[model samples]
Target: MIPPRSNRSQPLACNILRYRDLNRIERMFNRLKLFRRIATRYDKMAKSFLGFLHLTAAKLWLPGFVKRG
Candidate 1:
């Protein structure tokens, strides 16, 4: 959410929750960029790239669901 500037005649209302959610999603993309393959767009085919992207997302997400003994 963009904050209203002093010079603006009409300022828009920003939802704090929506802004926080957007921030979280942006952070996730930033994290994804940390992978060299993803950051560099090494895969030429869209299908393969999307498959790898899902795999990468699972790698990042699975830890929370799986329990370690």
Candidate 2:
């Protein structure tokens, strides 16, 4: 079946603020890539990588919260 189209015939919604922030976002992402594991992602296990991502997020959002190995 064919998908529906808008009666207004307008283009898809977009965020001008988000588009303007793309450069800054890219810079932040590049800076965040300094961590070796995050950049390479060598962990073969999904759980391990997920744990790594969670830990990274925790560290970023909750400053000074250290994850004990």
Candidate 3:
């Protein structure tokens, strides 16, 4: 799969895809879509949208690393 690029011109090619990575990314997007704000593009600015996206991603990622007692 093509990876993210700093500029919007075009994405660069990447190494071979792993099934596990693809699965995780798909799941992440599915979870992201569950948030109406994110799915509907409510943020008018790209920066704000990206900030919220990063916030959402961080929330999703936390459970994996945090341990419960």
- Using lDDT as the measure, the top candidate is 1
Pairs that collide, model 3? none
Q: In model 1, which regions exceed 4 Å deviation? A: 2-12
| Number of backbone-clashing residue pairs for each candidate, in the order shown | 0, 0, 0
Query: 35, model 1: CA deviation in Å?
Result: 0.6
Give the winner by TM-score.
1
lDDT (Cα, tens digit) per residue for candidate 2, span 1-69: 222355747656766677668867787667557768978987889999889877876676575575757
TM-score of each: 0.77, 0.49, 0.67
* Candidate 2: stretches off by over 4 Å: 1-15, 20-28, 64-69
Q: lDDT per residue, candidate 1, 10-51, as tens digits?
A: 978878788889999999999899999999999999999999
Which residues of candidate 3, in runs, are more than 4 Å off? 1-17
TM-score order, best first, reads: 1, 3, 2
Worst 10 residues of 3 by lDDT: 11-20
Lowest summed lDDT window (length 10), candidate 2: 1-10
Give the higher-TM-score candidate: 2 or 3.
3
In order, candidate lDDTs are: 0.90, 0.70, 0.87
